[model samples]
Target: MNKQTRPLLTLDQLWQFSLQYYSAREIKEACLHLQNHFHGNVNLLLTLKWLDEAQLTFAPQDWSTLTHSLTHIDALLRDYRDLRRKLKAQVSDALYKETLHFELQLEKQQQTALVNCINTLELNPCETPQLVEQYCLQLGAERLARIFIQPVQAHYHTP
Candidate 1:
């Protein structure tokens, strides 16, 4: 209800930004690399990127809340992902293709839920663009290079 509790970014905008960004061939390639090799969540990486683009900031408590909200849902996604891979291995072509479509939809559902949850959290945009990268890096580790074609490069020195 309050600013602190409501989402700072619109879910639709976040989804659109992520979708557009990920559609790029190079970005997709990099994200798949991280996802397949490092078990990175492409959606989360995109979400972090979106925040950086928006020049937004989040608190540690916000990260804790996000983790709590996403943990079970993320596990479900992992289960479905494993099942889908197994199905692909065991099933015939037509069946595998059909199941693949379902799996893709399931992934979108997860992304939607993620963006919606993020929208519920209150955040503040950076007063200066130079701080944008600093804010985004707090959300996760320095794996952006693995997931982004061009890792966001906003460098600022703190005195």
Candidate 2:
């Protein structure tokens, strides 16, 4: 609804543009055009353009599919997280002699699970701009930062 929340591109569209145009320049230009119209600022014109020309573009039909796909993915991720937490809660979960190795294995499992979750959402053309806009609204900038940063802080001590 708002200018800042527009979905300029979809995942599949991005891929197609990349394949057909051989670069994302045109898409980037479109984003910059939108930006100029909305904010009248040229500072982030290029970056906005690149984001606009990403490897995928969203579509109307893709919204339901994306919702379904993301729902399933979220469920699986939640289940995996619960399972890991339960495992950790078990006093006898790890072999006493293999504590070091077990910790390593758990860390690797968490990392692998996270990567898998991200990979599951790989950009596709079917994504709809409306869906992206909706997601952005739902998450907001600060929450988005937490979504990415919380995991890293919990596992990697990233500041």
Candidate 3:
């Protein structure tokens, strides 16, 4: 069949072509299909598609929102970790402390928001949302780590 007369390509086929040619719109369309198929878990892939799509619009305000959201999520996770550590140290029983530690680890593994945000941002940094989100995640992690850890400073001595 001639190119113009050929049947419309399925999203999967379009995705393959897009990958080979770097066609942003085709990739974006395929990602939307994947997003629908996988629910919201594929936000990163979807974000990449969005960024690559020539038709997609990237506004500055959207960047601010995306960045703010990522920062907020990272801060929340860090705060939760701190709270867990504090509770662990305060506990008198060794068994309880161990249990708390295990629980905290489990809780952290269950955290998808931060992971998804990071993945999405990294997929397409040229876009406002992707760039801002990545920056926020990086900065927030550094700032939080530095601002906390008072106990470590007071108790630990480097030899």
Candidate 4:
């Protein structure tokens, strides 16, 4: 389908897509690697995956707007994630699980904000690897980019 004919992506759809992929071990590892080593935004990376699935591509200005709009929330997520990691070993398993739940809520909030921003933007119709590559290169994480783009093994494909 062409750009005009393509359906707009919703928050629920994006969230479901994220949940499915994030549950995969390889995708989780790749996302965390990007986050830990390259300061990449997992929400955005997952959004990229969603967009690619939908055959949608963002324009340069759209990327700028989305990233700029998410900066504050992303900063909060980063801080909380760091704290969560630090507490993992120190806290009781139940407490750590609670922290993990809270972090997931924060991630959902970020995704909500992302969908709102996306609704106001103009998107193109094309293969999205170039866009993903551009984003990965900007993060200086070419190796992680390959992980994102490559197809996972069949067993790992199940969400």
lDDT of each: 0.64, 0.36, 0.38, 0.80
| Candidate with maximal TM-score | 4
- Per-residue error for 151 in candidate 3, Å, reads 31
Ranking by lDDT: 4, 1, 3, 2
Candidate 3: give the clashing pairs: none
Per-residue alpha-carbon lDDT of candidate 4 for residues 1-159, written as tens digits (9 for 90 to 100) = 356854477888999888877888878988888888998899988887777666778777677898887887988998999999988889999999999999989999999888878777787787544656677899999987787775334317434
Q: Which stretches of model 1 miss by more than 4 angstroms? A: 2-8, 127-159
Better of 1 and 2 by TM-score: 1
TM-score of each: 0.70, 0.30, 0.26, 0.86
Tell me how candidate 4 scores on lDDT.
Answer: 0.80
lDDT of 3: 0.38
Model 4 clashing residue pairs (backbone): none
**Positional deviation of 39 in candidate 1, in angstroms?**
2.8
Judged by TM-score relative to the true structure, which candidate is superior, 2 or 4? 4
Q: Tell me the tens digit of each residue's lDDT in model 2 across 1-159.
A: 355653443444333433333223543353344333442112122212223334344344543443443343344444544555556656474543355455434434333333233333434553222332333334343322222222112322225
- The alpha-carbon deviation from the true structure for residue 154 of candidate 1, after best TM-score superposition, in angstroms, is 14
